[model samples]
Target chain A: MKTDPESHQRMTQRRQEGHVKKQAAATVEKGLLIVHTGNGKGKSTAAFGMAVRMLGHDQRIGVVQFIKGALHTSERDFLGSHAQCDFVTMGDGYTWNTQNREADIATARKGWDEARRMIESGEYRMVILDELNTVLKYEYLPLDEVLAVLQAREPMVHVVITGRHAPDALIDAADLVTEMRLVKHPYREQGVKAQRGVEF
Target chain B: MKTDPESHQRMTQRRQEGHVKKQAAATVEKGLLIVHTGNGKGKSTAAFGMAVRMLGHDQRIGVVQFIKGALHTSERDFLGSHAQCDFVTMGDGYTWNTQNREADIATARKGWDEARRMIESGEYRMVILDELNTVLKYEYLPLDEVLAVLQAREPMVHVVITGRHAPDALIDAADLVTEMRLVKHPYREQGVKAQRGVEF
Candidate 1:
């Protein structure tokens, strides 16, 4: 597998050339519909990280969390404190605790109302629908309705939706989709209690 | 496919019971060797997000970036400005930009030196080795050496290593590993230029 130095050099040059071409060819720019979903983790954390990047650029962002509202989390508190960020935690709590379809649907609708405003009003450069996919998976919000709203959002605003079991329609509609597949989760596999900073 | 509401309620309660049991069973606590790998976006972003989480808890963090020292990044600027964070940007630029093998190895070693200090010193609760897996993949630093250092690090200090093509040994050693699989990437498939706030 190890090529000679000259061959290695040629391969590197070719790779460099291809990279340059790809960079040059990528000229189109617009808003991105990004989805982060899978069984692993970092789905929402990555969105929060993107929100931080926007904040670093001094851009305003709106964050709406659909689930995990039952307990206090550091990310919610941290982002909310920033003047440029508007963070909202929705739902009665963990869906398991509620275990009521009507209540879950109601909470999802209320969260969607706030999310729809952020996506439609163009008030922020980036909007994060944290755990929206989980709601959609449970049919708390009609998938078609959510997709239609997302499809018609402002042209230059990026929206990141995160959670497990992202529907196929959303994946098809998304410009960027990353599935955070679990190789191994510390909490579930390693018997590690959800730590304050890591899990929350 | 849809069950009756009564059946659904029973299912929900059963799921809730399982959730509670899992939560209760997870009692072990220790520093984790977390790896973010695979060919996808958000590997480094997730690590940065974890740093933010630590910051939210008012905990100090050390971040050592391996390959992205090429351009000015908003995350670096933001974190560097924070009093509690020590951020170091390493290497000349991208791997393709600097295709010198010996030079690349030298740079990787230099960066690893700084990283070793943060990880071993235990001053910070979290240490982020951004793009370290890329260096490992290139064999710039012998995997065994890096693994040994990581294994001997302080018990309560967490280390997050990120990049694509994580070696099997690293995965085996990791306490948690989440592979950010590329379901779809806008920059490649959609011909979208890497956006400022999102890509960086």
Candidate 2:
């Protein structure tokens, strides 16, 4: 590709201006409450990716799984084994499989207890509440209690919540929220089975 | 969590029915054209997570980055070093920095050529076209030509395209499309600058 001298100079000037603005605008440093929710894939997967990123930075992480218990995921096998990772799976299974509402509520409460401990430990730089939104939506755990613990967490400890149908209260309190809108899903449309590596 | 015998039997029966339905419904197996777009974070991050998942399954992957050139990302540094990954960065920088439309187009074309080669090689199970949507949005590469090549690629070679402002044609062609809607962004709203491991 060839570049003209004038165009190169103009681009450089504009970029410099934008850089200055960005540098000035971005000045805060604190923990972030990130929420990922929608009717699409990659919600938990993205949160796992964040765990990997934090691991890359040599930061300690805690993972509390609320709703995936029937199968062993590759992420848990790989990332859970990492030295800086403290992994805990605390769910009977999906609500559909574990028909007993009382059992599901108990499991969710147990998971939330672990999550609270992780958030208060001050050892973990990041805590991933995988599928906690679903727990919240089902009223397995009270929203006010979750919000209270989150608000009182360490100043620099980031928390990531992932699942569908995040409550309005959680959304309002979160600093970063990404709704994974489903445009197309093969399993829903093409009768495609979830594979081991790709889906798990 | 405790479960009564009656509740357990009922749950097991219901789960058996659901399993039978899933097994019967899921029959197709083929490669997927996945697109992650919109004005939210984790599009590329989610794609990278997929790469990691594929890597765990011992599959080779090809990555062609189109526009992130100015800074070194930890993902590139880590994943590029893996034996199964072929990583290539083929852009000058963002369009705003490069200002020269001709140069940007040429760079994008070169990247597309590399992407096409990776898709046709038959060696990679997955190919990630990182930030290619931005390239397409700028009309740097002809849309029809890109789609044609994608459609013609090996049936089992999954392709992941990530960026914002995806065109309608691509969405229609994709098997799985996730629009990462931006509900909240720390950089834009909370004046939180991008950190090393988090953003990269």
Best by lDDT: 1
What is candidate 2's lDDT per residue for B1-200, written digit by digit as tens?
23565876587678868887987898777778999998987788888788778888888999999988422477787688899999999988767776667777889989999999999998899999999988888778889999999999999888999899998999999999999999977545567887654565
Score every model by TM-score.
Answer: 0.95, 0.91
Mind listing the fnat for each candidate? 0.66, 0.57
TM score of chain A per candidate: 0.93, 0.90
lDDT of 1 by residue, A116-139 (tens): 999999988899998898898888
How would you class the docking of model 2?
Answer: acceptable
Clashing pairs in 2: none
Q: Which stretches of model 1 miss by more than 4 angstroms?
A: A1-5, A69-72, A186-190, B69-72, B186-189
State the C-alpha lDDT per candidate. Answer: 0.84, 0.83
Cα RMSD to the true fold for all candidates: 2.0, 3.7
Residue B114 error for model 1, in Å?
A: 1.0
